[model samples]
Target: MTKKPRLAVLLGDPAGVGPEMGVKLLARAENRDAAELLLIAPPSVLAAGEKIAGTKLDVIALRPGDPLRFEAGRITHLVQPEPAGFAKLGECSVPAGQAVLQALTVATELAKHGAVQGILFAPLNKHSLRLAGMDEEDELRFMQQRFEVPGFTCEFNITDQLWTSRVTSHVPLREVADLITQESVGEAVHIIDKALRSAGIARPRIAVSGLNPHAGDGGSIGLEEIEVIAPAVERLKRDGLDASGPWSPDTVFIAARRGDFDAVVSMYHDQGQIAMKLMGFERGVTLHGGLPVPVATSASGSAFDIAGKGIARIDGLQHAFDLCVQIAARA
Candidate 1:
């Protein structure tokens, strides 16, 4: 008999569409049977989500004396810490942020200990996450600190069509210049290369997108192509990887879609994300690699703007879980 895969999931911000999305994912059979999934969440939080999403799932309390209800009825109850603050749905509250963080901390701990194969965090509100005392603006940064790894984050989107990333994310457009470096671009290339190979791509061809128009127009525009990106490509090629570019951003992605390469690495956040999202949109999944465990956060965030609408797109969440299962199998 094969042992079931285990995934520790965080029910992000009860106020957001996370609850609704979670409902849709758990309802699927592939998720229900292939793995043993444990949700690290508060009882009240889960209940609110269950009610709003209208999906029934087995809820096992992490805390003693915590409230729990199954699809048909409330099953066994356990005792748990009472989350403080207002349980306001569809709004940002300190309490909701704290709850989301609490669940994540627990889930990450489980993944770290190898209790679970992977850690899956649903969409999170960046501001709310910060209010939970995170000093960083994104989950990747927070996880990096929590795991004590530096310079190790790349978001991945997988749709019915394509997947990709940027060398820089979450920085201002004006700040893109100061951040692009040969070392940084090179690292992005190398990491993506490893990831593709691990996914079973052989000699994965990596295409790097230029920071400036027409790849610096032969230094007439900017030198990032010549100075920052090229050197990295050279190093990668010398390292025995099939890497190339500082290619023109305008046409490289189209070439990539036409089968020119396995993955197109870009200079900044939107450079890669724009195309990826356009292709993947609600279907793309964001991956967090180089952590203690292969953790994935949702492409969508706390949709406080649309909580309980029964309308949150769940392809991303489902993919997040599916990816978690795949990583767990590797582990």
Candidate 2:
């Protein structure tokens, strides 16, 4: 019999819908049947989530670093004490941030030590993370720093079967043009290619979106396609990769959604994110690619306003869980 992969799950940003979504995910018997789980967070946090979900959780309590034989159909946890001044729903404060950071830290360590095969986190409030002393710009960067990963790493936004990778993420729009060089574009293509292959797409077809409007209109609108984007595509082709593009950003995704390409290497964040969200906001997932251990989460943010309302959707988090399992099982 094949053993199920053990995954570490965290309820992120206690003040947001993360806790509620996590509760909903665990409420399903199928989720527990598919994989063994290690749910990390304070008991109070889960209790609060259960209140919103209207269903109590079945969890085996354990401390961090405690030895146990992980079974295939169960959820375990190392509970962190609820911090002082714990913020309520819709409040982004240091305590909420600290809880998120602490959960992520422990889950990641479990992955690093081979105790868990992958990690999945619900949406987190970036503002709270910063307030908790996370000096890095985002969780991906923070994870890279913590793991001391030496190779390339990026966040992959996925909707349905289509995935998108960007050349520059979390940068100002004004600086985007300057950042789109041949090296940068090629790197984006490479990473997306690797990500697609990891997700079981063999010989993945990739589209590279041009930086300028209408692919620079042959230098009439802009010259980035002529000067930077096109060359990267050609270079990737010469290296025997099934890559094609410098396609006009406007029309590329339409083809990708219609089954033309396995993924798209976008010039910047919003170039691809905007389209993916529009395509399937409820089913989108952001995967942390090129990490030694698989990591993923809902592409949507923490909906603080709807935290305790129990109306927050769980589709995105469910998609994240599916992808995490797919990648981890293969790993």
Each model's TM-score, in the order given? Answer: 0.90, 0.96
C-alpha RMSD (angstroms) for model 1: 3.4
Native-to-model Cα distance after best TM-score fit, residue 28 in candidate 1, in Å: 2.1
lDDT of 2 at 131: 93
Candidate 1: how many backbone clashes?
A: 8
How do the residues 223-298 of candidate 1 rate in per-residue lDDT, one tens digit apiece? 8888878988899888998888989998898888888788888888777777877666687788875676778766
Give the clashing pairs for model 1. 63-79, 64-78, 64-79, 64-80, 65-78, 65-79, 66-78, 66-79
Tell me the TM-score of model 2.
0.96
What's the C-alpha lDDT at position 44 in model 1?
A: 71
Q: What TM-score, to 2 decimals, does candidate 1 have?
A: 0.90
Clash count for each candidate, listed in order shown? 8, 0
**Which residue window of length 10 is worst by lDDT in model 1?**
70-79
Q: After superposition, how far is residue 267 of candidate 1 from its true place, in Å?
A: 1.2
Instruction: RMSD for all candidates, in order, please.
Output: 3.4, 1.4
